[model samples]
Target: MQPWETRLEEFIAQQYGLSFDTLTKAIGKGPRAASKLAQRLKKTGRAEVARVDCGSPGPWRNSANFDDPGEVPHGPLWIFSERPIAWGYLEFDPGEWRPKASTTAHLTAVTELRLALTGLDTDPRVWTSERLLRRRLKSETGRVEVHIHDAWVRDFTDADKVWAVEVELSRKFGEGRLARALSAALDAADRSELAGVLYFVRGAGLRRAVEVAATRLAHQRDVDHLPNLEIHDLDITLAQKGMRS
Candidate 1:
């Protein structure tokens, strides 16, 4: 396979599937070109459209729980082959993978960030899915049952630092869960297991909440006034692909 084609497959297999726009962005191809490539891969036994195989709103969509039938939770998904490519730091078994009906937004958002960061001219960031972080945290730190964040990142120029990126579309933490979750992830930061923890929130309320949580945690841990946590607007970057105030 060509280098770009290999990248396309890698992106698709990373999440077991990806939207056409994501594939296009990741492979640096136009939509039409990406369409052609998807077709070629389909014909070549590498991929198949989910709608065709599973039927619309079939098992894959998991839309039965929604009250509004017109609301399409996610774009048409393109399912790929079960063949594993052994993505660096990421662990995925395509054959046994089943994407939850609710996580489509989160999953796609992650790939968008991956594409945007990959396009950076300098110090490009490498995004690893939560799967890899989970395995690595357990194996390296012997910390099991920890709440893994959305994604982990490593900049090309900085090999020593591994950062955690959390995308919060809605309120993810409760009063108690907030402290516990941040505590677990921040513990990694304290031990130098994670260089930084970044929370990308959808709106002001969510952003403020995350910020407050970080502050409280810092006070509790007696964190050296130099905090390693930061909260940012998700849409502030190209990854969100929308307007922000």
Candidate 2:
């Protein structure tokens, strides 16, 4: 495999899927080049192509069922600028697992964040993926279950300290799942699991939900147990860093 081909696999390994445009931007190639690269990966059985939005975020990606399954179309993604896209048809890793179409942007968001911090470099102490964190936290928790954030980040200004990152795309309270999770997270922070926690929320509703959840959890536990919890609007946060939202 060529160096770029290896990089392509690395990207898929870290991010569940990404648009051809995203690949274009990351690899300094054009859409057509991205298309060819996708085909190459697909030929090697390492990737597959499909849209994320049947027109939802960019077009319905996989809302298609097997019976009349819509085409897993292939084409170049839209790239009007250097900014990476958060949604669109994608060339994705093939496996038993598939992320939901609606959350494809969520995966993109996380990918963009990683790119901003460390590009394609692998350094767990600097940026640990949630995939890896799952094992680490599971073993650390033992019987004391704790909420796992999306990823862990080394503070940009202070490399020695690490913080957990949560990308909140929607409200989890309505599903009856966030409160206990939030409380458990607070407990983990109290136990000094990491330096702190950061939440990047997709909307005002999510921002409010997180605020309320943190407040209630803080009260239930000690307010000091909040562990430097910080929340920011996802788009604005990314914009501040000149990254794609």
Candidate 3:
């Protein structure tokens, strides 16, 4: 493990009440590095290292719980950011196995995009899941409740153009379900003058599904009349290109 990563692991373990294994998993480190870092921390007597026993039965045990599917918790506990504008949680089956670290990383990517969008503009408009729903849906027929783990929106008032932006990360459903969400967003954009949609995916399979959705949206003749769609593969990092005005 890199020196900084090891140090970070130690710090998170001490500060955030996360176990060594949990810290390593949360930070997306390999087993070798994770073990090395944990050992170093133990040697320093800064924190204790213990193995996590996954004796649970569900598919989502170790990772954050976002897929309760019953009552979504409301607060800053789910949201993780330096300056958070959106809230999200890791999705997994209850009483099942824990989710992979990559799943949480995918969630972070969507959160990063939401933060980036907020930095791009400084509008007083608040971003929330409810607001996004109202701004993105028009007719009741096209309205389908999106499993929104996290979301944020900012209203831009340039030349009387109001744009509501939202980012979502989901893993339970397939491409068809995402298509339905896109349709709802499109309908909402038509009514409220939305700017675009930024959809982030964690796995390659989901990435392909999102790509297919993007292609369909791009080819749709009516899309030009609605909000634009931007698809982001969270597994990859963005290239630091020149700044845009």
Candidate 4:
């Protein structure tokens, strides 16, 4: 791979997804540079690129109006790439477009990943969303599947910290899913698969709730414990960093 192509691939793989503008700024490329690079990557079999439009529209939206899906359809300019590039169609209905929490969570993850790489001087060799979802573990609690929204590794002074990051924009974690995630984190901690589990919540109430729930669960467990876990309000972090506007 060429130098610029390697940089682009590393950025995309670390951030999971990035918009056209972010790509341009990161690589110091012109407006059309990312598009041309992406096209070349796709044509040369070096990478796969796709545009995604997210969120559920209002009730008036109809699925039939959506363009037929086969290859990744042309949509908003938000570009996503995966390592080994998972190729397929991403379909969405046209409706009253509004930002969704899931979509924002992903963007927030990308931001955090960038912060870690730059501020912590960590390598950009982290797992993306697709790779994180593909990881699973077997424990005495049964088969624990990892659904970590995002994860990455950071280099500390002495040790490398593997962090499993969870961006919670809403308090809508179902009981089963929350339980499974808790189990998986505990398993990862116990087996030294991860260095820590971090939760970035949108509100103080949600942060407190997560802390209480995790504390209660920890009290009930004897064999496995979560010692390297942290919950922070996402809004506060953004404000502190002047990232909120």
Candidate 5:
């Protein structure tokens, strides 16, 4: 296998999957170069790369506005092939499909994913976006439980400094959901080497709600051992970072 092919496989294996734009950035190449490499790897017959179609049609209007070419029917993300590759990695079989994502939710997730990519430009650590993060965390937890966070990031400077990132669009959390989220945070913090949990919410109302809920839970002596919870307004922060431009 070629060196770029091996790097592509490692990148996909680490992040689970990534869009063409992010892949380009991760590999320090232009879109055309990255696309060609992806194509060549698939053509090798030794790689098992699969495209994940982003089927949302609105809420962001132009799905391809963000560095995606208009060629692909649905803006797609590529994951390493499920079959084993030239590197002698074991076969990776994907599981049953989950329910479809709503246009709004999917768009919001894509925005968050882009913001995560922006972070990679400066941060030396690695980022595991959404579904991949869920899958990896599930496996880490014995494959019997589900993770609730949107992403998990590790600081390159400190391998022990791991952060669980959650991007909330507009879901109203009741007491039950809040309790479960808190419990999940506490359990993960206690059992793992997590440094903190970060919540990137869409609005001030949601941010305040999360802050209040997490604060209340943290104040409880029983749950005081949870990781530090930090909340930020997603849209405002993204704008401040000039990512929207």
Candidate 6:
């Protein structure tokens, strides 16, 4: 395993509540790279390596519960659902879990603000439901889930204007995965409802990869199908702006 890859694997295993084996599999690397990745992660001090149980079923398939429709109750604001949405429940370190709440809140606020600014009726109630935002994307390997936030304004005196937003925050994943996610979001949108795609990145080096992917995806579309793609660096300034007025 490459040093960075090992570091990433260890970091994810500790930070994201993923098992070492699971991390290795998700990372798709051999033993040497995986070992190196784990070692590198140890050096970062952002994560720790331990012999953890692989656990039962994967969180994506098992812990997610969607059968019961519920309203958004006030709390940490991890998710705000207008309606009940499916999600997985997994064990995570309380320390590492802190960022999850803030990240979700920031994204929710951005979605709402963008919609309002575009003159679309803003509904915080609907923001919690993943079902309304998530769609399946076709890929050579399989379908991947991509969440989309779309807004538009209709003028009584003029033609309607529209915009589409796509946000991705990935860790230890490759550009190919991000590309698949973006492609899925675009494919799911109605051409008439889309104005552009905003791609957000959180990991190192992945931003450049996403840029390339966005370019390639842009080429695949016709003049009308092509949505404006903009990449933003994830930083504290942007996060604070999204969170506070």
Question: What ranking emerges by TM-score with the best candidate at the front?
Answer: 1, 2, 5, 4, 3, 6
lDDT of 5 at 157: 71
| Prediction RMSDs, each to the true structure | 6.4, 7.7, 12.6, 8.7, 6.2, 17.9
Q: Candidate 1, residues 1-245: lDDT per residue as tens digits? A: 79656655665665556665566666666766766777777777766644322224533343322224654433344445445443331343334454444666677676676566553221224666665556555755566556677777784578888788777787765556766776776666556477878777777887787777777777777874336777778777753443112
- The per-residue C-alpha lDDT of model 3 at residue 53 equals 32
Candidate 2 lDDT score at position 94: 26
Candidate 4 clashing pairs? none
The estimated TM-scores of all candidates read 0.72, 0.70, 0.38, 0.58, 0.60, 0.37
lDDT of 2 by residue, 142-209 (tens): 43255667788888788778787777777775563777766556556557557777778888887888
* 1-245: candidate 3 lDDT, tens digit per residue: 56655444332321222433334444566645655655554565543433223343323332222224553322211211111111111111112122244344343343344333442222235444332343343356755454332443544455344443434455448546776677666565655555655555556777777667656765675553334665565435222211111
Best prediction by TM-score: 1
What is the lDDT, from 0 to 100, of the residue 88 in candidate 4?
A: 21
Ranking by lDDT: 2, 1, 5, 4, 3, 6
Which sections of candidate 6 miss by over 4 Å? 1-159, 171-175, 190-192, 219-227, 234-245
lDDT against true structure, model 6: 0.40
lDDT (CA) per prediction: 0.61, 0.61, 0.42, 0.53, 0.55, 0.40
Model 1: ten consecutive residues of lowest lDDT: 58-67
lDDT of 4 by residue, 1-245 (tens): 77656655655544455655555655566756767766666677755444444533322222222234343432334455533442221111111232233574467445554553453222434443433333333345644453344554543443556666667666656764655566566565546566677777777877776776787677777525558777777767765654444
* Weakest ten-residue segment in model 4 by summed lDDT: 87-96
